[model samples]
Structure formats: C-alpha cells, structure tokens
Target: MIYKVFYQPKPEQVPVRENTESFYVEASSEREARKILADKNISIEFVQQISGVFLEYEKQNLNFKVEQG
Candidate 1:
C-alpha cells in the first residue's frame, strides 16, 4: 500500500497551509509508514492510506513517486 505523509520540516515549527511538505511511502500499513519516518524528526500532520480513485489521481501528477523505506 501507499501512504501520503504530510509534515512540517521541523518538529518545533507549526505547519502552514501553503508551506507544508508531503511525500509518498510504500508500506504494509499506516503504523509501518509512521515507524519508517520516526528517525527523520519531522512533525507529522497526517498519514493517509491511498488507493482506488485517489491513488490513480495521484499517479497522474508528475511529482508522485513513492519512497522506499
């Protein structure tokens, strides 16, 4: 499965709507995805599982690439 991770670069900083960063990770589950990012020290806002129509839409984006952790 693929997950969309929304986060801020620093743990102490608040996420701004326009400044938030995101990436896609391939993991077996949401918990596994969170665990994979634990060492990065970023402030995680959301970990969403992507599939079906939404996954297809994301695939159309040029920047959509899943990171292998």
Candidate 2:
C-alpha cells in the first residue's frame, strides 16, 4: 500500500514548498513513517496519513492539497 505523508516544517517562520511531498517505503503503518522521520531528526509541524498515491497541488495562503490516485 502507498501512503501519502503530509508534512509542514516545524518552524512557522520558514516558508513551505509549493507542493506537498510523499515518501514511499514498505513500512507497515503511518506511525512507522513518523518514527522514521523522527529518527532522521526531521521536525514536522503537521502530518497526515493518506491512502494511495497522490498529486500535490498548492493554493496560496491556504492548506496544500493531496489528490489521491
């Protein structure tokens, strides 16, 4: 199964990238993904676990969109 990992930087002062990112791995769960990110020392402001592959789209000054495949 594919999971779309939604992440925002921990610092609100930092600008977010236009497109949300997805990382593919054979992990069993969403928590595992979070753990992996944590072990890598990547700080996240927010995250969501989504089903299937997704296309990223951006809306200015609003939440990013993840379109599931």
Candidate 3:
C-alpha cells in the first residue's frame, strides 16, 4: 500500500517543526514504514499516515466561471 508520511524536522535545525512536509512511500505495512524512518534516522517531531489526498489543479485550469449577482 501507499503511505503518505507527514513529518517535521528536529527542533534544533534551522527550519523548525512548524514547516512540515509529506511524501508518499510504498510499504508492506505501517510497521515497515516506521522501520524505514528509523533506518533513515529522520528526526520528526510529528508523523502520520494519510489514507487519501487530493492535489491542486493545473495552472491553466485554475480559472473558473461564476456569475456575479
């Protein structure tokens, strides 16, 4: 299954944990994902696995039609 890992860097780093990030990874199970993070030694203040996610539309598709009252 695909797991979306959201994480924040260690507090001591220049970029604090406030600015978080997420990435998709394929793993057999949640435990496996955790192991991967451990092996990589990523100091994360927070972590979560997202079930699903939606991406923004393309630049050209950003425009939308609406009738103003």
Candidate 4:
C-alpha cells in the first residue's frame, strides 16, 4: 500500500543544513517508507494511506484563437 508522508519540523528541534522537500512518497509498505525517511534523518509528522492514484490535466487559455475548434 502506498502512503503519503508529511514532514513538519518539531517545535524544539534544531535546524539542519539539509534540503528536505515538503512532499510525499509512495512505497510498497508504510513501515518500509518510514524506515527510509528515518535513515535520511527526516521526522515524519503525519502519514496517510492512499487508496488509489489520481491524475490531472491542465491547459492554458488564450484570446487569439481564430475560431479555434
């Protein structure tokens, strides 16, 4: 099962000179993913299991279309 991990710094934690992105990761299992994050010294504040995947599409709107279909 895939999981979404949210990492937030602790109130009393000291700053580290590392670049940790505030995002999520998908893994085979929650426990494995947590271990990976811990190995990187990242504290996971929250973890949510994702039931399935989602897709999104986007397009830009322009004025000069010349009677676009």
Q: TM-score for each prediction?
A: 0.90, 0.39, 0.50, 0.47
lDDT of 3 by residue, 1-69 (tens): 545565654535555545775555556776776676774545554434444332222112333221111
User: Which residue ranges in model 2 land beyond 4 Å of their true spot?
Assistant: 9-19, 41-69
Cα lDDT tens digits, model 4, 1-69, are 545555646524654435332444556677766766775555666666555332111012232111101
Worst 10 residues of 3 by lDDT: 60-69
Question: In terms of TM-score, how similar is model 3 to the real structure?
Answer: 0.50
lDDT of 4 at 61: 20
| Highest TM-score scorer | 1
lDDT of 1 by residue, 1-69 (tens): 999999988789777867788999999999999999999989999999999999999999999999988
Tens digits of per-residue lDDT, candidate 2, 1-69, equal 334455543534464675444344334566665666664433454445444333233222154443322
Task: Choose 3 or 4, whichever is better by TM-score.
Answer: 3
- Alpha-carbon local distance difference test for all models: 0.93, 0.45, 0.49, 0.48
Look at candidate 1 and tell me the lDDT of residue 36.
Answer: 97
| lDDT (C-alpha) at residue 50 in model 1 | 95
**Which regions of candidate 3 deviate over 4 angstroms?**
11-17, 45-69
lDDT of 3 at 13: 57
Q: Which regions of candidate 4 are displaced past 4 Å? A: 9-21, 53-69
Residue ranges of candidate 1 with Cα displaced over 4 Å? none
